[model samples]
Structures are given as C-alpha cells and as structure tokens.
Target chain A: MTYCLGIINQLGIVMASDSRTNAGVDYISSYRKMFDLSLPGERSIIICNSGSLSVSQGVLTLLNRDIQNKEEQNLHTLENMYDMARYIGNKSREIQDRDRPWLEKDGIDYSCNFLLGGQIKGEVPQLYLIYPQGNFIQATPETPFLQIGETKYGKPILDRTITYNTPLEDVAKCALLSLDSTMKSNISVGPPINLVMYQADSFEINRKLELRIGAPYIAKIRKLWEESVRHAFESMPEIEWEQETNDSEEDIFID
Target chain B: MTYCLGIINQLGIVMASDSRTNAGVDYISSYRKMFDLSLPGERSIIICNSGSLSVSQGVLTLLNRDIQNKEEQNLHTLENMYDMARYIGNKSREIQDRDRPWLEKDGIDYSCNFLLGGQIKGEVPQLYLIYPQGNFIQATPETPFLQIGETKYGKPILDRTITYNTPLEDVAKCALLSLDSTMKSNISVGPPINLVMYQADSFEINRKLELRIGAPYIAKIRKLWEESVRHAFESMPEIEWEQETNDSEEDIFID
Candidate 1:
C-alpha cells in the first residue's frame, strides 16, 4: 500500500508520496511511487501511482520506454499538462487492455490511479486524477488536490486545509502533515516519503524532501495533531445530561 | 458505506455509528447502522455495522430472530459480551456462507464487519470486532478501541487519544468527532448517528444519544472541528522555501 497526494494551490503544486509496498503484510518492501518526468527549467511532470504494483511499474516502464524511444508523445514532448495527462491515461488503458483478461483469470485486478500535475514550458501548473480505464478528471478549486491509494485516512486534513489560495510551500507542509496523519493510523502505509514542491511557472521541480521512518517532523505533526484533537474535544460543550450545567437540579447521570 | 467505532476506557465505554447506505453512487439511502439491546440498570449492548447492507441487515434480522424464537442464542440470552460477540461473528459467517458465492457470481462481495461493545450484568465493559469469517478479537489497553468501515480516515484520533483511562463520555465524544471527520471527507458516509455509553458496573444502557441530520450539537461539532483543523494548520510551522520571495517569483506565479 502507498499514499500519494498532489495539490495545486495558488502558489503552485505540492506532491508527496510514501515509499512502501507489500505483496502482503509479511512481504512488505519499499518502492518509490512518485516519479518526475521533466527537463529542468523547461517542463515538469509528476506521476504518483497506487494499486497493483506490477501494473504501475508496467506503466512507469512504458513512460520511460516512450522517453527512450524519442517519441513525440512522450511525457517530455507533451505541449501542456493536459496532453501529458491524456498520454498517461491512455497508456494506463493500453496496459490494462494488455493485462486485464490474464489478471482476471487469476482473480486479480489491474487497477491503478495516477495523480499527474505540473507545467509545460508555456502552461500553468495543473493536476489531474487519471483512472485505470483511461479517463481522468482535473482538479478544480473546489478540490484543488488529488490523492491516490490509502487516501481516505489522510483526506480530512486535505478537505479542511487545501485550497487554490494556499501557498505552495504551506501546501507542501500540509500535504506531509496529512500523510503523517494517515501513516500514524494505518500500518499498511509505512514510510520513507518522497516529497516535491513545484513553484507554479518555473517549470522546474524545486526541493525534494526525503523522510525516513523516524523523521522528527513527522513524529511532531502526529503528536501535535492528536493533541489538537484532544484539545478540541475538551473545548466542546460538555454533555449537559438531563439538565443545564449552570442551574443543575438533581440532574445526576443515571449511571 | 458506514463508520462505527467504540472504545472501552477506564472511565467507561463509548460507541458511535453513522447511518449511510449506498447501492452504487446513484442509489444512496439512509439506514440506521447501529442497534442496541439494553436492559436499563442491568446491561447495555451496542452493535455497529458496515459493508453489504444486505449482509448486515440479514445479520440483524437473525439477531431479531434470536430474540423472537427463544431458541437462538441472542444478546439477551448470552452469558457475557464475548459470547454475544461470538454469536454475532457466527451469524456473520452464516450469512456469508449463504450469500458469498452468489454475490461472487455477480461480482459483489457480501462480507461485512460488526463492532460489538457493551456491558453485561456480571462482566466489565468490553468491545470486539466481529469479522465475516465468524471470528472475533477483543480490544486491549494497547488498542482500546475497534472501528469498522471507512475506518482509516478516523483512526488517528483513537490511536492518539484512546486509552483504558479515557472517560466514557469523552470516548463517546471522540467517536462522534472521528465520524464527523470521515463524513466530511467521504460522501459515502452521512448521518443521523447513534451513540451509546456504558459505565463500568452500572450494567445499564441508559446513556444513548441519537444525532439526526441537522441536529444542533452535531452541527456545532462539525463546524467547530473544521475551524479547529484550519486553526491547527495555521498554528504549525510554515515551510520555508529556498526560492526567493521576489518579484520574479510573483511574476512567474501570476502567469
């Protein structure tokens, strides 16, 4: 299992992913799920994958193969982020078509989801969630972020904190924090995380932060977030039982 | 399609569940996912469910059948909460055995999970997660809670705040807040929520709360929880970027 999120806020795009995979609980391993396809200062593309390892690795191999083939439809050759997304989505469909029946016969699903986001030399940063069936959806201001794999556990923070107006670096921080929240709660999503921040029109991937399992900031965020919840519950109105708190009159808890 | 959790703390027991059912996204319905059988001043039992609505409802029907037949081993007839849990687990397996292959033939999974917690006349408050295979596990101090269905989104809070020492009412409040977080992030879950609390040695089922949609307190909690998350993010350290906070950055960003 892995988790990857890409946010297109006002400042730019922030992408984060965990580097853990498992065939089963006992066969766990680390595998990078975030890949960058860009010529620095010219164009940038980020792909975060989740689902069947073989399928995603297959897709990645195809993308790299396209890059090596000197093809015009390569991630590097796309004129804009949209075309890049379509190319990836189509590639996913191609792989599915190749693998589906065989996988089905084995009672396996060739399912994968991709979050593609970045800028082509002349275009603005954009994010798209590409589904396994060769279709995709763009991220809107209403949902300025896309997450794939083990997304739900990290979604509350994203739903509440991510927006188009958020700063690029803050978006990065929040993205990591959201993943931190998820990793703390689920054993299936362990770490060594790969994080990248893209400043809107630079067409270059900025700093990448690599987080090991015992990273300090990750621990800090997890502890603080839990404290925040406890504090919130403490601040909520206390249960009043059968009567109001200020003028309680024999309103004892029946227990 | 549902989220339900319960924790047994030193102060008491807390259980809460959401009420949402969906047959694909187009055919969503609201069904109460929590049911309780309690003898006030004697004992209290809360059962929360998630998964194939048919399977859960079938299990509930079987429980009710037990109540009616005077022959089936029901919660009321069980000697302890563990026995009741085993009853639920066994019934789940019974339902799965009857429905699994048929659902598999149609490409649907009939597996369901049940979270059962309560106090019986002579036992301490307890909690169990009953799996579809007719097996179960109890919660311990190291893991004083159990969650079923869409659980990942809400688990960090329990991982951080739940302990054998958490007060019963606080446990209930935390459970609702956890559900609120999941409901905010996942549309598959909605409310009217069911909450139940049991005090140790009280053996009573008096502390139960039902939160209908638009209920005042629930609304307050949801509103406040979102605000709290935003505020928490603001309180955290902002990521410092290596890029200049200069005109070129602004110029590049605007394009």
Candidate 2:
C-alpha cells in the first residue's frame, strides 16, 4: 500500500513513485520506491518511499550508511533542503528505534514515510514530508505538494492541479496523472512508476522515468487521461431535473 | 466522518450522502445522513448512514422500534431486498450489542455502516452494503457501487463511471460527483448533500435532494464540475518532451 508523491512547482521537483510492495496478498513485489540521491553537480537527493518495506529498507540502508560512513549528518553532508529533511528524519527515527521492539513481537509495523526531494549546491529546489514521527514538513509557496503513500486516491488531481506557478512539464503531467489515479483506485498501488524531474537549478538528475504496466508513455497517459475524463464527464451540466421540477413548483407556490 | 453512496443503475437507485457530524473539531453538527423508506405502492427504503453517530442513531432507533411495534420482522415486515438487508444487518448488530460495552469504556467508537437502497414489491432494484459486522454485501452486476464513510476520496468516480448500465440520470450525476469528490478531499465530509432517486418499477421515491452549501442546484453542480475539470486538464495530450528525447536517443543507440 504505497503511492508516493512530491511536486514543488515553478519549474522543478516532481518525484512521484509506486512500485507495488506487499507482504500479504500473496507476497507481491516490485520494490524500487524511488531513491536516486543525485550528485552530478553537487547534491540533488530524491527519496520517495512509503511504509514498512522493512522500514523502507531500513531507511535506505541507513541512508546508504550515511554516505558510506562520511557521516557527521549525511545525505552528502546536508546543508539545505531542510538539512536534507533533518537527515531523512534522523534516519527514520534511527530505523524505527532499532526495529520497533522486534517488529512489535511479530505484529510487524515498524512505520515508514518519506518523500524528501532535493537541490543543495546553494539551496532552492526543495520539498519534504518525512514523518513516521521523526517529524518534518517543508513544501510551501502555499503547499506546493508532499505526499507519502496511498495518499487519498491521488488527492483530487493534486487538489485541482497543483500551483506555486505550476509547469515543469505541467508538474510532470500532474505526476503522471497522479500516479494514474493511484494505479486506478489502488490494487496496492502497483506499477513501475518512479518519475523524478528536478529542473530548478539543475543539479542534474536529467528527467527520469521508469513507467511499466503497458508503458507506451503509460499507454499515452492512460489514453489521454481516459479520453479527457470521458470528455469531461460528457460535458457535465445535465442534472436539470426540469429545473428541479420548476424549483419544486416554486416551493408549492410558497406554501 | 461520513460519505455515503449507492448507485445500482439501469435507470434506478442512486442514494448519496454527506451531512457532517463530529464529536471533535469542537463538536460540529448537521445530521440527516439520508433516510427515506418509501411505502408508496409499497416499499422503497433507502438508509445510507456511515459510522458511530451513536451507532447510526442506534440503528435508526431499533429500526423505528420494529416499525413502531408492528414487529414480527419490521421495515414493513421485510421479505426481500435481502430481507431488507438482513433487517438492517440485524438492527446493526443489535445496536452494537447494546452500546458496545459502554462505548468501549470511553474510548468510544461503537462502529456503524450501511447503505441498503430500495425496491421491494416483487423485488428487483437493490443495493445493500451493511457491515459493522452483521455482514452484508449485495451490489453486483460487477459492482454497481456501494460506499460508506470517507470512502477513498470518492472512489475514482465510482471506479470510472459505475455500470449495471449506468443512466438513472447518469447515476444522479455520478452520485453528485461522488459526493463532490468526498467533500473536496474530506474535512470530515461535510455539506447538506443527501440526494436519492430510485426508479425501476417505480416503487416511488420520486427523486429527492438536499444540497445546501450555496445551493442553486449545489451551485450549478459545483460550477459544472469545476469547469469540466478545468477543461479536462486543458485537453491533455501534451507531454512530448521532444519525443522523449528521441526515445532516450534511441536508448543510447541500442546500448
């Protein structure tokens, strides 16, 4: 049950994710919950993740072992993007405080959640989210976006088309039509979706992609957003009910 | 928090709901979570409900005190419509087993859930749902809809326009645009929304509605479904990215 997201508009940051991952429903799998901690021209991070894939692979193997032990606050020695979202919320609360009491004696839930986003070589392109209690938030310009998992069937088209001056390829085609309307009403959000984008100061991630389930550009953005949402629900406006029975006959001629 | 629904189709059954209720958020109000119960030409029931408004007003006051003591199985001595959805799932598990052990010794939550739908005289139009454990299910013809509570931000437009032949005024404008996209991404699902419909062999519900929040036909179906979903996200299709950078430079000239 995962459906990651991240937008931050004005020509940068997109991030999206969804690569199934189930411990039940016959142990489904597909992993890659987006990671790519860029560094082409110095700092770019990505992160996505959702919940308990062993606490998002133990917070990405303790954030790639704090950048292969160059620690002292890693994520390539954070200095911006909110200290790399407080160093991935302190390594997702230090791996859910060392495996949440032995995975809650087998009930197993070791919570997870991330998002992150990037840009550092002298800050700017940001975004965040973090929480599984370690705490974080960020994304602004009046909430440019930041979701974690299975977020409300892809939040009403990012609450009616994102903002902060949208456009970075229309927020990567509204984050692949909000992860294809959350993998079409969720089936544990399957797909090889991934996405990424980052163009702000271009620390360079070179517009990523991934897609999968019949990917011809995800079947032409799901057949042009389901034929433009069934031609915008057949050009709405019909419910007149004969002007609601003439406004209930003018409320029975004003009683 | 609530957001009812129903649907069915071939020109009948629609339901819909959402009339916020809260015990927190400083006790918000407004009730009537759709009810009705037609008898015109005998039997048309409706119900709708969601959760714990005191176990849906104690399972609608014990199914209206077993139809005001004319018991011997009430809801007009149910005989079909799955015996009136197993008599409203056995009076919602007999009012959550008579007030769930003093509402779980104060942690409250005496669960509730229902949908029910109509038609009885020689039964045909139906719906059901019912759960909080007394178990119920019905709606078929490959899922003709049935939701309750803040159901997944109005389930991807009833999983992309319901079926069983969808038409009863386009399933009452897709159940008022799926309860206005679950009251625009849920703030505990609000508004005076109601709706109703039922048509089939006209057991008679004669179209109902409630609307409110600037109700001029719910402000013209929320200004024509937000201007036909912002003109269907501005006529989709744009995402060439220079033919995906010449198909990623023909996959780097075939590796």
Best by TM-score: 1
**Cα deviation of B217 in candidate 2 (Å)?**
34
Model 1: DockQ against the native?
A: 0.27
TM-score against native, each model: 0.87, 0.39
Q: Top model by lDDT, which number?
A: 1
Per residue, candidate 1 scores C-alpha lDDT tens digits across B1-255 of 888887887777788888888888999889878776565566777788888888888888888777667774676788988888888888898888888888999999788899887787767788899887779999988888888998877886677677777777777778888888888878898988877677778766557677878888888877887788777777776554345332222211110
Runs off by more than 4 Å, candidate 1: A94-105, A240-255, B52-74, B91-110, B240-255
For candidate 2, write residues B170-194 as lDDT tens digits.
7788788878877877777888887
Candidate models: Cα lDDT each: 0.79, 0.78
